[model samples]
Target: MNNSRLISLLGISTLRAAPRDVHLLYLSRFLRTAAFGSTGVILAVFLSGLGHSDVRVGLFMTLTLVGDVFLSLVLTNWADHFGRRRTTILGCSLMITSGLVFAIASNYWILLAAAVLGVISPSGNEIGPFRAVEEGMLACLSANYDMSDIFAWHIVAGTLGVSFGTFSTGWITAIFQKPVGWTEQESYRVIFIVYTIIGIIKLLVALKLSNASEVSRPTVERQQDAEQEEAQPMLQSEETSVAKGPGPTALMRAVRIFVPELTAPTRSILWKLCLLFAIDSFASGMVAFTLLSFYLHSRFQAPMSLLSSLLAIPFIFSAASSLLASPISKRLGLLPTMALTHLPSAILLGFLPLAPTIELACVLLILRAALSTMDQGPRAVFLSQVVRPEERTKVMGVVNTIKTLSQSAGPTVTGSMAQAGNFGAVFVIGGVLKAGYDLALVGLWLSRRALAEHDDIVLPNVNDNLAENEGESDGTSRV
Candidate 1:
């Protein structure tokens, strides 16, 4: 089979399938996210065990973000042309390779190499074609599916993956503790095994899809054929109208298609939201690695079992919260919901360190969980409303790359702060930063005046463009 057909064999398609297709895609995403979850919980632990300093760990994660910058810039542009599915498969393969590298590496350089190859700049979150093509493909699949609802479902699956991986990794560590003579650091090697296993499954899923379902014919052929069949006089008139004005060059049109400008009101709102997201991510990143791990070890002297169970709580809450996002968005408006949830979560994160007991900590953690994830779906909806549809992938790519970089930096900063015996400082700083983020959102909502009521808007170019823009089917203009 030719390359395009081979890609379709792997589930990349031009003509969107039914909602059933998304279900399969969602399943793949869930699995992918679950594998990713293990890395989030374990990477800090692993690096610290290797006697790496907080700054070094931070630098290590930064590499991933840096790598993502170059990689995503190129890949997203490529995805606009080649199918998202094909590119996603390639990214997944890289993730698996990274996992194997982590499994064998003992020194800092090896870990750094692994981060470069596997963890740092990876698209574990956004690499999939399913997401890149989501709006277009879903619109093609069924009118019943709401973009908001789909995003909510996506977040739910993500939380589920995170919970499963985090909990499982902790359990795996505890189970192997005695048999493997587990030192705290040594236990981390097991996490790599889990990562590898997840990667392999994702690879298999990608390779098994059919490519014939994805490729479509060129658009020019259809236009030419249509012209040949039209009434002669009418065709001549249409040709005359077309010839009267010069068409835009492909490159100029593509630039406009990919990067859209936000209106004056929307611009300020989006900037504030972006700042909020950045702060929230930064704080979340800062303490994410140190908080749970330290809490479990320091307060309760608990084994892996308890930590695993605690890790599961946020996922449970997030799953529940996602189902309610759409209604909440409808009821409260996207901006309000986004800000409200995040502000409260920031408060909760700040207070988490004050819990006097493990049960209290866990409860606070659960509360934090619900509040933190509640805004995810709404935030996505908020973005879609403000920006042109075609620019979503590029915007998301840029934003995601920044988030990844912040996350990488978070661990190092938090780790260093904690190492200095000011563990509480991490939570305090993170919470304050998150609160600032929430407050900024408030300003965004106030600044924008022409904010429309929550009505559904659909784009027609979504379906045909998915294939055509990807250079898979030549019928449409390139993105």
Candidate 2:
């Protein structure tokens, strides 16, 4: 095809390939993340203003993570049975309640209760069940499109939303404090009110999702019929014997109903991925953007407005990196792309505490941000590709839940250390641990690839399924 015609065709194909639900999902992620980003920037500052010490601040953050871990585990594991839209709306409602409590409540115990029982993002990132279910839905909906590109755009949307929220909160607080004659505490409360409004909007958007967003469940009868049809001649007698044996017990049937049955290889890969991810998440908790903001304020006595602008820089770089992730993954492969980009960022984090001036620290932070999140898109795509279709939600839920559990420990320890005047140690510890995770990930990927090659096992290509689906559709040309 000629160059002009080829370019036009590609544009049309891309537009046609994206479903309405995927676009809505992106919009919902942006709105929800904006709320999280804004609250995360101010959560620690607001709590400390309420006369709580640094240890209490850290304890609150840890409890918030524990609540999220529990809720996410239950909601995501049964999302297929309960319906994704319903679970997502329920999560949004919890966020709304959390926001309201933060906006109005002043009692320390009351706020702590709200933090522990309600959905909130103390890490300035996804902390509820929304991500696990949404990722599974996006993977299913984008099966016929460019999976990497779709995943890249999703992260880009979230990063940009977070950037806007972080930057705006600082300015908003400043404005409210000066012209509006509000105290710093009151100004922060206004931000939480905005968070509540955003949650309401997200809830409405989630409600608009179509029935196509529901998870696909396979029935036992259909599985049995397919197995019978595919049985080989030599295996027919064995299959019949098994089928004729006593039916599964009540406990086994319940297990099958709620839990997905993954093949042995898929299960093994899922467990390894979860372990690696938990290590990274635990490190992340030590320097969660929320706690990091608190650290900057307490250690350097930086102003909130300045801190807000500095924090936003990383999200901007992360957004740009997210857009570039698809092409990078295409060139470098998923595992390599994840490892190469992440290692440098972790090394940069190790140097953050050594900067003598705020300006130098901000510069290092921006550079780290540019490289840190480049793995997000590729990692999501890798997980989606490794598991069976029906197992996607379950696997994503399990991984996310375990990661949250691992991360919950970091804040308590870091908080106590910071309270004890060991402010610089957390960054060094987090950076070193993350760097170790990156190295181990690379080793695992190499070993797995070698074993697959040695055994002559062919892995499925993500794009091959898209091409096959296109061919099966009506004879319209595809790019």
lDDT accuracy of residue 165 in candidate 2: 91
Residues 40-120 of candidate 1 have per-residue lDDT tens digits of 666655666687775676666656655654555555544534655576677777777887888777888877776665543
What TM-score would each prediction reach against the true structure?
Answer: 0.75, 0.87
lDDT of each: 0.59, 0.80
Give a tens-digit lDDT track for model 2, residues 1-479: 89765533333344356899998999999998999899899898898898988898888888888887878877887777788999999998989998999899999888877777787788999888888899988887887778877778788889988988999899999999889999999999999999999999999999999977775444223333433443333243556557866333434445544354555556677778778889999999999989888888876888888899889988998998876777777777788888999999999998888988888888889999999999998888877776655556777888888898889888888889998998788898899999999999889778867877887654434353332222222212111
RMSD after Cα superposition, model 2? 6.0
User: CA lDDT of 155 in candidate 2?
Assistant: 88
Candidate 2 matches the true fold with a TM-score of 0.87
Give lDDT: candidate 1, residue 301.
Answer: 68
Candidate 2: what lDDT?
0.80
